[model samples]
Target: MSKYLLNKFLFTVDRDPELVERYRAEPRATVEWWESARANRILGCHADESSTWLCFEDAEREALAAHDYPRLFELGAHPFLTLTLFIAMFERDHPPLGFQTEYARRLAHVRLPYPDIAT
Candidate 1:
Protein backbone atom coordinates (compact mmCIF):
# COMPACT_ATOMS: atom_id res chain seq x y z
CA MET A 1 0.00 0.00 0.00
CA SER A 2 1.19 3.54 -0.67
CA LYS A 3 1.87 5.35 2.60
CA TYR A 4 0.26 8.43 1.14
CA LEU A 5 -2.99 6.52 0.91
CA LEU A 6 -3.43 4.52 4.05
CA ASN A 7 -7.16 5.07 4.25
CA LYS A 8 -9.52 3.06 2.03
CA PHE A 9 -12.86 4.86 1.81
CA LEU A 10 -15.73 3.36 -0.09
CA PHE A 11 -18.33 6.02 -0.84
CA THR A 12 -21.98 5.08 -0.88
CA VAL A 13 -24.69 7.58 -1.57
CA ASP A 14 -27.62 6.46 0.48
CA ARG A 15 -29.87 9.43 -0.03
CA ASP A 16 -32.64 7.25 -1.34
CA PRO A 17 -32.59 3.73 -0.03
CA GLU A 18 -34.41 2.61 -3.15
CA LEU A 19 -31.99 4.45 -5.40
CA VAL A 20 -29.16 2.13 -4.49
CA GLU A 21 -31.27 -0.91 -5.21
CA ARG A 22 -32.53 0.52 -8.46
CA TYR A 23 -29.00 1.31 -9.61
CA ARG A 24 -28.00 -2.23 -8.91
CA ALA A 25 -31.02 -3.59 -10.70
CA GLU A 26 -29.79 -2.59 -14.14
CA PRO A 27 -26.58 -2.27 -16.11
CA ARG A 28 -23.94 0.00 -14.65
CA ALA A 29 -21.91 2.71 -16.32
CA THR A 30 -18.25 2.18 -17.17
CA VAL A 31 -15.96 5.17 -16.87
CA GLU A 32 -12.31 5.67 -17.82
CA TRP A 33 -10.01 8.61 -17.56
CA TRP A 34 -7.98 9.83 -20.49
CA GLU A 35 -5.33 11.38 -18.27
CA SER A 36 -4.55 7.99 -16.79
CA ALA A 37 -1.11 6.67 -17.58
CA ARG A 38 -2.10 3.10 -16.80
CA ALA A 39 -5.27 1.05 -16.59
CA ASN A 40 -7.59 3.05 -14.36
CA ARG A 41 -11.00 1.62 -14.76
CA ILE A 42 -14.33 1.93 -12.97
CA LEU A 43 -16.07 -1.35 -13.65
CA GLY A 44 -19.51 -0.20 -12.56
CA CYS A 45 -21.37 2.21 -10.29
CA HIS A 46 -24.97 2.43 -9.14
CA ALA A 47 -27.24 3.12 -6.23
CA ASP A 48 -28.84 0.73 -3.80
CA GLU A 49 -30.91 1.27 -0.67
CA SER A 50 -30.55 5.02 -0.79
CA SER A 51 -26.89 4.70 -1.71
CA THR A 52 -24.88 4.83 -4.87
CA TRP A 53 -21.93 2.49 -4.72
CA LEU A 54 -18.98 2.88 -7.00
CA CYS A 55 -16.88 -0.14 -7.82
CA PHE A 56 -13.38 1.02 -8.63
CA GLU A 57 -9.89 -0.47 -8.90
CA ASP A 58 -8.26 0.92 -5.71
CA ALA A 59 -9.36 4.49 -5.19
CA GLU A 60 -12.03 3.85 -2.61
CA ARG A 61 -10.25 5.07 0.50
CA GLU A 62 -7.11 6.15 -1.29
CA ALA A 63 -9.18 9.06 -2.50
CA LEU A 64 -9.29 10.50 0.99
CA ALA A 65 -5.80 11.91 0.49
CA ALA A 66 -7.10 13.82 -2.49
CA HIS A 67 -6.58 17.57 -2.39
CA ASP A 68 -10.04 17.57 -3.84
CA TYR A 69 -11.35 15.08 -1.35
CA PRO A 70 -13.33 17.79 0.37
CA ARG A 71 -14.71 19.14 -2.87
CA LEU A 72 -15.66 15.67 -3.97
CA PHE A 73 -17.31 15.04 -0.61
CA GLU A 74 -20.29 17.34 -0.82
CA LEU A 75 -23.79 15.88 -0.67
CA GLY A 76 -25.38 14.52 -3.87
CA ALA A 77 -21.82 13.54 -4.74
CA HIS A 78 -20.70 11.39 -7.64
CA PRO A 79 -17.55 9.35 -8.15
CA PHE A 80 -14.48 10.98 -9.65
CA LEU A 81 -11.85 9.89 -12.19
CA THR A 82 -8.46 11.14 -11.04
CA LEU A 83 -6.72 7.98 -9.93
CA THR A 84 -4.65 8.03 -13.11
CA LEU A 85 -3.04 11.28 -11.97
CA PHE A 86 -2.51 9.93 -8.49
CA ILE A 87 -1.00 6.54 -9.41
CA ALA A 88 1.22 8.33 -11.88
CA MET A 89 2.69 10.63 -9.22
CA PHE A 90 3.04 9.05 -5.79
CA GLU A 91 6.43 7.70 -4.56
CA ARG A 92 6.68 5.46 -1.56
CA ASP A 93 6.63 7.24 1.82
CA HIS A 94 7.03 10.72 0.45
CA PRO A 95 4.58 13.49 -0.47
CA PRO A 96 7.11 15.24 -2.80
CA LEU A 97 6.97 18.45 -0.75
CA GLY A 98 7.77 16.27 2.20
CA PHE A 99 5.93 16.83 5.47
CA GLN A 100 4.55 20.24 4.80
CA THR A 101 3.18 22.30 7.70
CA GLU A 102 1.62 25.28 5.92
CA TYR A 103 -0.33 23.22 3.45
CA ALA A 104 -1.75 21.34 6.36
CA ARG A 105 -3.31 24.59 7.59
CA ARG A 106 -4.15 26.57 4.45
CA LEU A 107 -4.99 23.57 2.40
CA ALA A 108 -6.03 21.26 5.17
CA HIS A 109 -9.26 20.20 3.55
CA VAL A 110 -8.05 20.64 -0.02
CA ARG A 111 -4.72 18.87 0.13
CA LEU A 112 -3.75 16.45 -2.59
CA PRO A 113 -3.10 13.09 -0.99
CA TYR A 114 0.16 12.99 -2.89
CA PRO A 115 1.72 16.42 -3.14
CA ASP A 116 4.12 14.72 -5.52
CA ILE A 117 1.39 14.76 -8.16
CA ALA A 118 -0.04 18.26 -8.71
CA THR A 119 1.42 20.48 -6.04
Candidate 2:
Protein backbone atom coordinates (compact mmCIF):
# COMPACT_ATOMS: atom_id res chain seq x y z
CA MET A 1 0.00 0.00 0.00
CA SER A 2 2.72 2.43 0.96
CA LYS A 3 4.67 1.46 -2.13
CA TYR A 4 1.70 2.33 -4.29
CA LEU A 5 1.31 5.70 -2.60
CA LEU A 6 4.94 6.48 -3.27
CA ASN A 7 4.51 5.42 -6.88
CA LYS A 8 1.51 7.70 -7.17
CA PHE A 9 3.47 10.64 -5.83
CA LEU A 10 6.31 9.92 -8.23
CA PHE A 11 3.94 9.52 -11.13
CA THR A 12 2.08 12.70 -10.28
CA VAL A 13 5.23 14.72 -9.95
CA ASP A 14 6.78 13.23 -13.05
CA ARG A 15 3.82 14.39 -15.13
CA ASP A 16 2.95 17.61 -13.32
CA PRO A 17 5.73 20.12 -13.01
CA GLU A 18 3.36 22.59 -11.38
CA LEU A 19 2.76 20.11 -8.60
CA VAL A 20 6.48 19.78 -8.10
CA GLU A 21 6.76 23.56 -8.04
CA ARG A 22 4.00 23.70 -5.49
CA TYR A 23 5.80 21.07 -3.43
CA ARG A 24 8.98 23.07 -3.65
CA ALA A 25 7.29 26.34 -2.75
CA GLU A 26 4.91 24.97 -0.13
CA PRO A 27 5.78 21.66 1.42
CA ARG A 28 2.78 21.68 3.68
CA ALA A 29 0.46 21.94 0.72
CA THR A 30 1.28 18.40 -0.28
CA VAL A 31 -1.74 16.96 1.43
CA GLU A 32 -4.03 19.45 -0.23
CA TRP A 33 -2.51 18.71 -3.60
CA TRP A 34 -2.79 14.97 -3.04
CA GLU A 35 -6.37 15.29 -1.99
CA SER A 36 -7.17 17.28 -5.09
CA ALA A 37 -5.40 14.73 -7.22
CA ARG A 38 -7.20 11.80 -5.69
CA ALA A 39 -10.53 13.56 -5.92
CA ASN A 40 -9.99 14.29 -9.55
CA ARG A 41 -8.69 10.77 -10.23
CA ILE A 42 -5.40 12.30 -11.20
CA LEU A 43 -3.54 10.13 -8.71
CA GLY A 44 -4.05 6.49 -9.51
CA CYS A 45 -3.82 5.38 -5.91
CA HIS A 46 -6.10 4.08 -3.27
CA ALA A 47 -8.15 6.78 -1.52
CA ASP A 48 -7.34 5.78 2.02
CA GLU A 49 -6.65 8.70 4.32
CA SER A 50 -4.87 6.65 6.95
CA SER A 51 -1.44 6.22 5.38
CA THR A 52 -1.49 8.67 2.51
CA TRP A 53 -0.78 12.12 3.92
CA LEU A 54 2.49 11.69 5.79
CA CYS A 55 4.61 13.99 3.71
CA PHE A 56 4.11 17.32 5.50
CA GLU A 57 6.12 17.26 8.67
CA ASP A 58 9.55 18.00 10.09
CA ALA A 59 9.68 14.59 11.75
CA GLU A 60 9.88 13.08 8.31
CA ARG A 61 13.33 14.58 7.96
CA GLU A 62 14.42 13.40 11.37
CA ALA A 63 13.18 9.92 10.63
CA LEU A 64 15.23 9.74 7.47
CA ALA A 65 18.25 11.30 9.11
CA ALA A 66 18.16 8.69 11.83
CA HIS A 67 17.81 5.85 9.28
CA ASP A 68 14.60 4.86 10.95
CA TYR A 69 13.05 3.32 7.89
CA PRO A 70 10.50 1.50 10.01
CA ARG A 71 9.11 4.69 11.44
CA LEU A 72 9.07 6.43 8.10
CA PHE A 73 7.58 3.49 6.26
CA GLU A 74 5.14 2.84 9.04
CA LEU A 75 4.07 6.44 8.76
CA GLY A 76 3.27 5.85 5.10
CA ALA A 77 6.44 7.25 3.57
CA HIS A 78 7.67 5.38 0.56
CA PRO A 79 11.47 5.23 0.49
CA PHE A 80 11.49 6.51 -3.06
CA LEU A 81 9.06 9.24 -2.15
CA THR A 82 11.37 10.24 0.63
CA LEU A 83 14.13 10.61 -1.94
CA THR A 84 11.79 12.58 -4.17
CA LEU A 85 10.96 14.82 -1.24
CA PHE A 86 14.65 15.42 -0.77
CA ILE A 87 15.00 16.31 -4.43
CA ALA A 88 12.06 18.64 -4.27
CA MET A 89 13.49 20.24 -1.16
CA PHE A 90 16.74 20.95 -2.95
CA GLU A 91 15.34 21.80 -6.37
CA ARG A 92 13.09 24.39 -4.76
CA ASP A 93 16.05 25.95 -2.93
CA HIS A 94 14.82 24.61 0.39
CA PRO A 95 17.35 21.88 0.85
CA PRO A 96 17.31 20.30 4.26
CA LEU A 97 20.73 20.24 5.88
CA GLY A 98 22.37 16.82 5.37
CA PHE A 99 19.55 15.75 3.10
CA GLN A 100 21.94 14.13 0.68
CA THR A 101 23.49 12.00 3.39
CA GLU A 102 20.11 10.99 4.63
CA TYR A 103 19.13 10.03 1.09
CA ALA A 104 22.27 7.96 0.68
CA ARG A 105 21.58 6.29 3.99
CA ARG A 106 18.13 5.32 2.84
CA LEU A 107 19.38 4.12 -0.50
CA ALA A 108 22.00 1.99 1.16
CA HIS A 109 19.32 0.42 3.27
CA VAL A 110 17.09 -0.43 0.34
CA ARG A 111 17.16 -4.23 -0.15
CA LEU A 112 14.21 -4.54 -2.45
CA PRO A 113 14.09 -4.11 -6.19
CA TYR A 114 12.30 -0.86 -6.81
CA PRO A 115 12.42 0.62 -10.29
CA ASP A 116 13.19 4.10 -9.02
CA ILE A 117 16.27 3.00 -7.14
CA ALA A 118 19.14 1.72 -9.23
CA THR A 119 20.06 -0.73 -6.53
Of the candidates shown, which would achieve the greatest TM-score relative to the real structure?
Answer: 2
Residues 1-119 of candidate 2 have per-residue lDDT tens digits of 23444445545664677766665566546645564455235334455533434342455444433435445554566556656655654644435556666556655654554334221
Model 1 earns a TM-score of 0.18
Compared with the true structure, what per-residue lDDT tens digits does model 1 show for residues 1-100?
2221121122221233443333233212201221121122232533222223323334423233243433333211222322322222232235665423
What C-alpha lDDT do the candidate models reach, one value each? Answer: 0.29, 0.51
Candidate 1 ranges with C-alpha deviation above 4 Å: 1-67, 74-106, 109-119
TM-score of 2: 0.44
Specify the poorest-scoring 10-residue window by lDDT in model 1: 30-39
Clashes of each: 15, 0
Q: What TM-scores do the predictions have?
A: 0.18, 0.44
Q: What does each candidate score in C-alpha RMSD?
A: 15.2, 8.0
lDDT of 2 at 93: 47
